[model samples]
Target: MIATTSLQRMIGALAALLAAVGSASAHPHVFAEARLDVVLSADHQSVKALRHLWRFDELFSSTVLMQFDKNSDLKLDDAELKDVADTIFSSLAEYDYFQLVTVDGKDVHMNAPSQVMTNFDNDQLIVLFESEPATPIKLAGTIDFGVYDPTFYTAIDFTEDANMAVEGLPSTCTRKVIRPDPDTAIAQNQKTLTDAFFNDPTGTDMSKIFATKLELTCKP
Candidate 1:
């Protein structure tokens, strides 16, 4: 359950903070758009890797690009790019890279990243990385795959269904989107919380109530 707790903790604090503000439009200080590709191993029996593309908001991108551009070249050369890529990827290691995979309701651990790259487009920071599950499992029955920031510090959004794709999977397998909705009772209660509630950081994971999840189901 450590993994589950990690997933819930990512956004729990952020959700409480947002609820205290009492406005939906006030949230998501950091904005990011992402696309994920699920790569399958040869023979199509297990998940081999995950390829990710994350485009950060302009404000954050500016900060990162400025820091990543070494030698004051105003351009990220090969060495500079790799430096930034490794830095970002390494930093995210503590958060499990916000990627979660489960088979039979159990979490799967991902090994160290094999590839990391970065680019800048229209003043936005774009990152690409690839990783594999520590223990690959057979591809059949039900599989749960989702990407989330657990911490609300950065809001990861997939603007369209097409943003996520599966590669090397049989046509019989299908994927679906699972958008989480806040519990009505919990939503109502948040409105009446006292200042003390916000001060006390201990509480349930309200973020999962609003976090989005991606589910992939396969035919047996």
Candidate 2:
């Protein structure tokens, strides 16, 4: 017969092992091609985000929202939300070819629900903050090639050319727009295209046209 204390210890050990296994299983390690579109408020107050609009060969069944902070350690406050918005907007403006224009010569603040939906896959997602009302901001661009494998690492190589039209912002504040050089752009496009051939669901390898471009548009 087994001692009661020994049985209890065995149960606890089993539980711990199960937990570790579950955590490992939760992460999917397969890589797939993806693209993302991120929009930001003119005053750097919030962001309107989108993703996975243009898939080269339809490798994924549905778009899944990979939690930005999978560990749940990073919580968003009012100030943090604004900071995130500013970071995204500024990053796009500096690294990509994007235009920021004032709307009707007014600084408009806006708000929306915490959650937003995608039209292509009907995927429901939550944004950390809402867009302020009366503030209209728009972003348009494209990402060429990227990969997201939950179990491993998410790697993406792409360029975006966006135009941000803001309702109320100072004219003196100018946003910079940057784009990739020809060689890097071509390489990213080719890598993305090649990856699709191997991972696409159809199992038939298809040659992607490196010259093709993807476009994204956001309106709020």
RMSD of 2: 16.5
Q: What 10-residue stretch in candidate 2 is worst by lDDT?
A: 146-155
For this target, which candidate reaches the highest TM-score against the unseen true structure? Answer: 1
Flag regions of model 1 displaced more than 4 Å: 1-27, 183-209
Q: Stretches of candidate 2 above 4 Å error?
A: 1-57, 61-113, 121-152, 155-158, 163-168, 178-220
How many clashes does the backbone of model 1 have?
3
lDDT of 1 by residue, 8-108 (tens): 22222244344444533224566789998888888887788888888888876665556656587777778877776766666677767777777867778
Q: Count residue pairs with overlapping backbones in model 2.
A: 16
